[model samples]
Target: MSDQPVNLVSVNTAPERAKKVIGTVIENVKDKYTIVHAGNSATIDGVKPLLLSIQPPPGILFCASMWTPEEQAEIQQIARETIPGIRTHAIPTGLQVQVGPDGVIKYLMERIDDIMKV
Candidate 1:
């Protein structure tokens, strides 16, 4: 398996919750995979910070956001253009579990693990 990191992007509004989720995913994977909390960015330009800050490997992007459909599409387009070849899994705001139930975290971890094994 590759040691490449899985980037998880979400809205900047919930920093603490994002941190917790990032930590949980890292711990759950036992650090076998690098889980990067790519931090919050909901715009096409906002993605610049993530691209500049992290040289993320070719892995999944777990995007959880509360943006409008238009905004989501723009972000997705920007990500595809900027990152080129990486898989993205968008988790709508309604399904995101920042805290409490570990369903989201579990799902993400599983997806990442499966990808890594490939």
Candidate 2:
């Protein structure tokens, strides 16, 4: 698990009512990664809103921080329960310091590097 690679998925919204979430991951994330861009509909039993449509579950599921710790916990729980063997890591969402994309990306990369060293 220590040597596992990280994945980064970008969820961009579209103007059309159909196909809300474009399941696309950053090409440079790794040689292998999973991108599950589910619809905006709510999930049952307090689970995360997003759903996984891909067959043969992904090896890793990456999550970002939520506005509150409780929300973060809920997302983490959802990922953990949904995929039996998938490992998940959540970094800061840059909301506290209100940083721009570059700063957020730098900080996230640093955090991931630190995690990989462990």
Candidate 3:
């Protein structure tokens, strides 16, 4: 699959409807992401920074391209501002772990083998 990012138009002003259009483009996939381009190749929308997960189907063998690197820090900052010592950890993937203090990501541990080193 290609790593090129897809552009996400605003839902209201887009040439096509959000759910209706993007839906048809990705129906039966049963995944949050859309394959904007196809040909042994796929591209995803930029709104990926807003995505929460890319879960695997029961019969599927794998899932890839989960968290993005951009510091979509608003969500994190909100958590810190609203709460105290609220440690949040999300293992969005089996090997990858995210630990948040309040809301800011303290670190991302992608390999248990490297945990001690980290």
Report the Cα RMSD per candidate: 3.5, 6.6, 16.4
Tens-digit lDDT track of model 2 for 1-118 = 3233333222212212112212222232334332333332222333333436534444444444323555555666776687665555554553324764445455544554443332
By lDDT, the better pick of 1 and 2 is 1
Compared with the true structure, what per-residue lDDT tens digits does model 3 show for residues 1-118? 2233232221112222223433343442324333331111022332222222222211111111132322223323332343333222222332222322211111221221222121
Best by TM-score: 1
* Segments in model 1 whose C-alpha atoms lie over 4 Å from true places: 4-12, 42-44, 56-60, 97-101, 114-118
lDDT value, residue 54 of candidate 3 = 23
- Model 1 per-residue lDDT tens digits across residues 30-108: 6476666666554456665665566553244545655556666666666666677656666555556444437667766
In candidate 3, clashing pairs total: 0
Looking at model 2, report the run of 10 residues with the lowest lDDT sum: 12-21
How many residue pairs of model 1 clash at the backbone?
A: 0
TM-score of each: 0.66, 0.50, 0.19
